[model samples]
Target: MHTDLWNYALALYARPGVEAACLQLQEDGADVCLLLCASWLQARRARVSDERVCALLALAEPWRIEVVQPLRTLRQQWRMAAQGDAALALLREQLKGLELQAERTLLERLQACSQQWPAGSDETADDWLVRLAPDLCRDHGALDQLRAAASALQDAEDGD
Candidate 1:
């Protein structure tokens, strides 16, 4: 499995609308990360799949293909064509873009979820979400909007 791609999807899982999409995809027996990676790979014109990635690399069946194959391909190509630094550099840039998008999406989701938290419960809402889905909140990073929501709730509680 491509660790980078997996991390990217894991980050995206914290996004708004992504959890629902991920749940639906999960229900359909698809790895959400793999799907996201596939989308990235498709955009990059990389002909790869989670299945092929697992088969070739002996990684988990539901691994992210986008991260692995392109890197692997780049490495192989670089080995064959030592002067192909440009191609490798391009692939790295694209991966960085994907990472940034994933991070932004995650922050958006966290903000949305925090906004939708029930009134009269600042820490409670965060706790509930953390309990319900730890992966989304596990050191995922500070969401300033969510923090504001929590702060507002705390103030309300103090006023009461």
Candidate 2:
């Protein structure tokens, strides 16, 4: 049985350094959701292409900018005030949850977009990440950490 993208993301994110790596990537203007999808695609050995990447971006960019980014911005904006105010902290937590949910929904949409693409690719093993990751993140050690974690996650699952 194949693992769905959400679960795969959760498991991968739970891995050591992955969360930090993702955050670092996000800081560098990379989309964590896109990176996760890239890792998942590589793990599944799915084919990678310009059209497929474009399709994923086309489906995800608006949702990220309009939905995820706003919630995340609000949460970040409240970080300091929320630190001192209990009620504000609660609201910020709620906002954080909403942001998470928005990202999850984006992941689900991405999965749906690529679900029909068959596993097994003519592309190189790293092609998915290489293509999907932001150029700014291309040489970051955080990116390497994510790549390592994804590989370890794939090995652990295959061992199951």
Candidate 3:
């Protein structure tokens, strides 16, 4: 497993079903960056607590709202326009890269904030997922899928 949060995120996001699952969670008001951070923490075997989860969200929420989402919205909005206009397609691609960088930055900051946290925990990956997105649990199917994906990521990391 990659120790750097950005690399870890890229690898995890590429896994089958993860991108779609993350988008579903995001549409349900979950912060995908924080979720990725939670996954990273789980991969590292970090102790998770409500307080720690709250603190990480506090650090990530504003930037995600102000910087990342706007870029994402604009990039998505341009999808139709970009399909026909070559120049527009080029510019949209650039915005997509910027949006990705913004997310990468958020992940880096999350990693920095949690660097001092101690590892060694018996908590399952679902424990962190539940703590991070409690509301999602209301949808059992979605929550179960997310938990499975997260657990798979942790299992893969453990094997590395």
- On lDDT, the candidate that comes out on top is 2
- Could you tell me every candidate's TM-score relative to the true structure? 0.28, 0.95, 0.87
Candidate 3, residue 62: lDDT: 94
Deviation in Å, model 3, residue 67 alpha carbon: 0.2
Put down candidate 1 lDDT per residue, 85-134, tens digits, no spaces.
Answer: 77866666676566446434533333232333223322221232122222
Residue 16 error, candidate 2, Å: 0.3
Tens digits of per-residue lDDT for model 2, 45-123:
8888889999998988899999999999999999999989999999998999999999999999999999999987766
Candidate 2 lDDT: 0.88
Model 1, which residues run further than 4 Å from truth?
A: 1-3, 49-58, 62-160
Better of 1 and 3 by TM-score: 3
lDDT of 3 by residue, 1-160 (tens): 6778788888878878888888888888888888778777877778887789888989998998899999999999999999999999999999999998998889889999998888767765446666777485446465567567767877887784
RMSD of 3: 2.3
Q: Which candidate is the best by TM-score?
A: 2
If ranked by lDDT, best first, what sequence of candidates would result?
Answer: 2, 3, 1
Give the C-alpha lDDT of model 3: 0.81
Better of 1 and 3 by lDDT: 3
TM-score-based ranking, best first? 2, 3, 1
